[model samples]
Target: MPAFDIQTARFNMIEQQIRPWNVLDSGVLDLLASVRRDEFVPPEHKALAYADLEIPLPGGQYMLTPRVEARLLQDAAVQKTDSVLEIGTGSGFLTALLARRAARVLSLELSPELVAFAKSNLQKAGITNVDVRQGDGSQGAAAQGPFDVIVLGGSVADVPHKLLDQLKIGGRLAAIVGDDPIMRATIITRTSATDFRTSQPWDCDAPRLQNFAQVSRFTF
Candidate 1:
């Protein structure tokens, strides 16, 4: 079980860390209230599950702060019938969240060990709607193409164009774009066959995914 007092603390975190940041979506807040983040965290870090900070995992990757997760979940605007794709399935925390909100969730993680861990965690959580895979996230889950929503849990200097290309008409994609000292959380929607509109939702700093990066300067 999680810390002896997670339920009350979770409500407190919402009133404190998240609501002050303007995360006002009722559906999103309900999710934060419903999901027991402690269940997904490493046993050692379960006590700090509701804190507004990242929780470390066996791998170097950390589960993103609750506010960030809640904000993104709100911006994604998931519908219960939607099919969602999530890049960087760290700790399977967000995967379970998406599974609850979407008809199905296709989550991709690069680390083989993390993939194994997530599958186990999802099973332990009794989540049946999420498909956890060990693969590259930048490639997008092509096999499950035409997703209704795509979210990159990590950040990149440039949005993955290929991933956006897979979005169905009217589908949306959310990502943190830019590197350190300047990362903006941007949402892009596929407006038409060949048009997209981008909006800056908020400023954020998330670990960059392994393969998505701006080309480094080469001084030859």
Candidate 2:
């Protein structure tokens, strides 16, 4: 294949894919533009870095689409003073984005290989504010409690209450919820110690997160 114009492709991804999807936050747009996504993609898939599709990772997990990633980042409204917890740190692309906006980020991935991959990528990008760990993210990092933001890089049938409890009051969590074929991009804000408000602002499907609580199926 011929050499691709990476700059032009990145610009089009922000303008055509992300911006049109309602990711209008200036800081988020800037971050999206500044982050070199191609560097995080596996060599074989580097050409698809700016494409509107999930790039495959070592594990079965995938990097979220550009629009989905940008939308989640914008919706979470991460601040420089905030601490973030990110689930499913696939290629660490989103982790880098979160680190750019937050004071610190603790990212979890189920696959040990992915953990190492993400760490390497983040380190190469000079992102020091993130700690990538290999573990099941469904339980959330309670020991690191009261994070200002929690983001699930994949979809879940439901956002576990355990994870929500890990949020600081007024903190926000973003996830794609529901089964495949149709899922809602939902954001939950912890209004108080015992109250959380949720809104489904858009629809998208992502690979289901492993180890999350599943609805029991019973038959008579």
Candidate 3:
């Protein structure tokens, strides 16, 4: 086991990088303090676990920066009774964090390899409330319909309609919007049966998830 001061470094990073960028949720802070990020990262990359940079995974996928991950978790405003939908389960670190905050969490991963790894990570962390599934997140997890909070791990060109259909009224969805260089993280909440509102939280950069990549319709 890699031994490092997890809580102290996590607290410092949360205060220095994340809080400066407007992350002030006590719940989120607590979750970050409790969950050990180093455990989820590759043994060789464990030193970079809390750095404010993306961590490369086995696949082409990478874990979001600690700041971005913390920001998303804070913006979600997770409740103990809420059920969460996580679109990408990279290392299961964030999934475990959500498992601690939410009543239940369903995370979908496009890579079977990642899904298997995540399940092992989650098990190692002793988290039982999170369900990791292998599938296309954009198509949406219909069987686990009506999530109270839906979170996409990567930026999307637009919010998938299928995701909107799966949110219960008054539910919230947090995702990074736009493409490349300049993308803003946002939250969309269903206020009523017919009303929805969107809020931009902060600037972030996340690789597009294969599950939610926009399709090209024409070639010139």
Backbone atom clashes (below 3 Å) for every candidate: 0, 0, 0
- Model 3 pairs whose backbones collide: none
Candidate whose lDDT is highest: 2
Write one digit per residue (lDDT tens) for candidate 3, span 92-189. 99899888999999999999989998999999999999999998998888787899999988889889878988899989999998877879999999
For model 1, residues 16-130, the per-residue Cα lDDT tens digits are: 9999888998887887888778878888887788898878876688888888888888898889989999999989988888888999999999998889888988999899999
User: lDDT of each structure?
Assistant: 0.86, 0.93, 0.87
How accurate locally is residue 202 in candidate 1, as Cα lDDT from 0 to 100? 92
Question: What is the TM-score (0 to 1) of candidate 3?
Answer: 0.93
Which is the winner by TM-score between candidate 2 and candidate 3? 2
Clashing pairs in 2: none
The residue-by-residue lDDT of candidate 2 on 127-187, one tens digit each, is 9999999888998999987899999999998888999999999999999999868899999
Better of 1 and 3 by lDDT: 3
- Model 3 lDDT, residue 9, Cα: 73
Ranked by TM-score, the better of candidates 1 and 2 is: 2
TM-score, cand. 1: 0.94
Give the C-alpha lDDT of model 3: 0.87
